[model samples]
Target: MLQDYTIKKQPTKTSKLIASIEFILVLLAIQGVLLLFNQEVPTSEVAQFRILANSNTAEDQRIKQEVQKKIAPLLDQAISQSTTQQQLHDRLQHLEPTIEQLAGEYANGSAVTFEHKAALIPPKRIGFAIQQQDVYDAYILKIGKGKGDNWWCALFPKVCYPEEATVTETEEEPVKFFVWEWIKSWFS
Candidate 1:
């Protein structure tokens, strides 16, 4: 029974200091992750583009599609010269007459009106960026009565892939976790 007795090793001050440092490091890592997760995507930097239909009639819808096809490229080209939202708005404002003319080319006798306004829009998902149902500065082309369903896209970020564009999804990358490896390093 006397031979079976064993003494336990007591923790040293250096070991206590190392444990305290490790605890602080883990807390910092947790805080970094929390900050990343809690951050909201800023909406002020986004610019919205829209085309409102004259009415839901087949002919009206067809004209709307034609105007969409024609004017989108021009808008892209115009904004390509811009670097800021204000510049984008200015470029569009300066080009409004031209835009209205081009929109009318495909509108086919339908009235077309263009404007830059603070407009209320529905929540929209365009790529990974989302727009909540809120008012935003927008470039709007109202076709005819403008009483039907609308077409919208993210004009500034260019996140909305066109329906005609083809997209190939990449395979998911494997996640390499480092927290376990980091903890294991303390023993080695």
Candidate 2:
């Protein structure tokens, strides 16, 4: 009996194209899921207080610090006592004059203005939580030109200082995705 040999046919162009498209689709799906996972969710409903400095000079920076020091205690007290956003807003509004006076005194009579608005704040580490870039209801205390770096803290939740804030174990742990891990294992 003669020995038989078999020749395997090469994949067709269409089949190759389909395979490439399928691979791309899988990649896109994975990317989409990862993007979704990376999305940041606010851990708590809280308001932010941001104080912008007039300039980056030593004097301006010192003034900003002084203003923050004066306002921190008052903010902490008001925020701790308030329960809702409205209450916090009302409290901040009530304290606007006092805050302005403090800022003005430290900033050499620099015009101080208070603005309440939804602002896009960048990623920040507030006490124990890392906040992502998102729009938040903020009480902005603009000093003088309002053209310098800002100091921000969670005013409503009273997480301004690390020592004063409490962090749970779950909050400190990083987010895990078992499904993503399995998918990665398959690729590996």
Candidate 3:
């Protein structure tokens, strides 16, 4: 029988380089998978409510209903009052105080400020009532429209686009404005 011989193999530079590249690729793939897992998963439903601390659960529902009923009439009244061009400012001013009072009352010692967008601008707030009761606090419709004319689908964390307040020469032109194109440019 011939003497048994064994040879130990040393890793070659080419093999080492190949292994390193493969390891790096594997790490990258793993990182990609982890990133995918961590990405924000959107909820199918837009409305997600968190329980407010010290909120009266019973009163909240009742209040939400009341708010919805009031909105339509309030808006109509505002438009009617503003029918006269000169009285338009007065119409806006009249509504501001009422909203402020309502917001303050609703806040219940917690601070809240009412913000109004230009009339030509899309509605920022849209409220719906719970079938159970006629209360203003049941559901507050917070809406935010994007740069497009598309009616803002109500969403949380209201969207605000910076607009310049300008006095217009003609009534037909928007009094204050930020075109969607200009707003987009600012971001770019």
TM-scores for the candidates: 0.56, 0.57, 0.28
Candidate 2 lDDT trough over 10 residues, lowest sum: 154-163
Model 2 whole-model lDDT (C-alpha atoms): 0.76
lDDT of 1 by residue, 68-180 (tens): 88888888987788898888888888888988998888777878899778877667765544557677878789987787654444342122333323344446588766865
User: Candidate 1 clashing pairs?
Assistant: none
Instruction: Name model 1 segments beyond 4 Å from true.
Output: 1-41, 151-188
Model 2 regions lying over 4 Å from their true place: 1-44, 150-188
Give each model's whole-structure lDDT. Answer: 0.75, 0.76, 0.41
* Candidate 2 residue-wise lDDT, 72-133, digit = tens: 99899989989887888899889989988887888887899889998767667655446876
Instruction: State the local distance difference test value for candidate 1.
Output: 0.75
For residue 136, what is the lDDT in candidate 2? 86
Backbone collision count in every prediction? 0, 0, 13
The worst-scoring run of ten residues by lDDT in candidate 3 lies at 129-138
Query: Global lDDT for candidate 3?
Result: 0.41
